[model samples]
Target: MLEILFEDDYYVAVNKPNGLLVHRTRIAEEKKEFALQILRDQLGYHLFTVHRLDRGTSGVLLFAKSSKVATLTVKAFEERQMEKLYYAIVRGYTPPEGTIDNPVKPDKDHKHKAPQDAITHYKQLGTVELAIPVGRYQTARYSLVQVVPETGRMHQIRKHFAHLRHYIVGDKRHGDWRHNKMFFDELQSPFLLLHAAMLGFEHPVTKQYMEVHAPVPQNMARLCTQFGWKDVLPAAVFPPASEAL
Candidate 1:
């Protein structure tokens, strides 16, 4: 079942799981299930999606209960009033904090031909040096980071990470193959480590400011515990004060 984050008269928000689709799409056929369908079934009423989360990323996804609110919420996103925050496990120790100011555009190099104009900000959360015996002395070190994007672009976070040269741990399409193989073969993880952790926006109906938080999924939590980092990582559930509703 999807974790209900916030729900009310005219809208609902949820923490979507990794490997689950936000809705139907041509590229990723609806093989398993979707957030929208499950939410409607659970709530016993239809809802309209105001925004989305990546199929591989799990976290806060918002929906509108009424078409009137949905239209306004969509405009809010288009006007950049809504804010989204994310967290991800990367393959190595990153800088203390940084921002990827580069504009995301279509990846002319990629055959799939995805869109662009993506910009994101990232900060180092904590470090985990799990030197698993892949073959020899070449064990690995990884870092967990929190990401907030100003503009919502397709594959923005994944594409930005690759541009920085420290790609996310399990991004199959945009990550390094050697590390991916190592983590998959050794750690037995099936999905990307990226997650959508939080969403902040103004309620269209009530005009109240809100920010909803989503906890790290089971797999990422397990990884942290396995690496002896349960307490080392900062509190994800309790966001910073500025972001608090």
Candidate 2:
């Protein structure tokens, strides 16, 4: 069953797991399972998607119960009325706090199209160094960061971090191969480290503000605990001590 985070008469939200598709797409035609189908069947009602999360991302995904509500929710997103918070572990230490203001293509195929404005604000939460050699460095360094994307663009966080040279761990498409291989071979963590931890928006029908939080997945939680970063994450999203690993 999907892990539900929030629900109401007009909308529903779930903690979408990594590797689950939101819906059918030409890129993943062979995939049989999707979050939309599973949640619709589980709730026994038709649902409408308001936004999308990448297949490798796990976190709060919201859906509207009706077409009208879906339209309103989508409008909220386009107007930048919704707030999203993401957590990630990257290959090197990031600035204590900084905003990455860069433009990115809409998608991989849009090379000829003008890039769209994309801004990402990030705050470093914790840092760790391991006595392990990979490439030229005799030690491996990483940081845990809380990220807020002011402008939602395709792969903006991943691409911006890549441009800054602090690639997100396990990001196969935009990361350092040696560091990714190190985590895979030594830490046994091959999943993308990016997670959508929270979503905040006003209810379209009720006009009341709502915030939904998705606990960090076990794989990511275990790594955070190992690095002593548990205290920096929101308490609501951290798993219990007994269940974290």
Best by lDDT: 2
List the candidates' TM-scores in order. 0.87, 0.97
Q: What is the C-alpha lDDT profile of model 2 across 29-104, one tens digit per residue?
A: 9999999999999999999999999888899999999999999989989999999999999988888999999887
What's the lDDT for all of these models?
A: 0.80, 0.91
Candidate 2: regions farther than 4 A off: 241-244
Instruction: Write out the backbone clash pairs for model 1.
Output: 104-116, 104-117, 104-118, 105-116, 105-117
- Candidate 2 has its poorest 10 consecutive residues by lDDT at 235-244
lDDT for 78 in candidate 2 is: 91
1-245 in candidate 1: lDDT tens per residue?
Answer: 78898888987888888888888876668376788889889989989998887788888889998899999999999888988878788877899999887766664556476455667888887887766754353678788888889898778899899888888988988887777888888888777888787788878777889888887777777776676556645566533331222
* lDDT over C-alpha atoms for residue 38 of model 2: 97
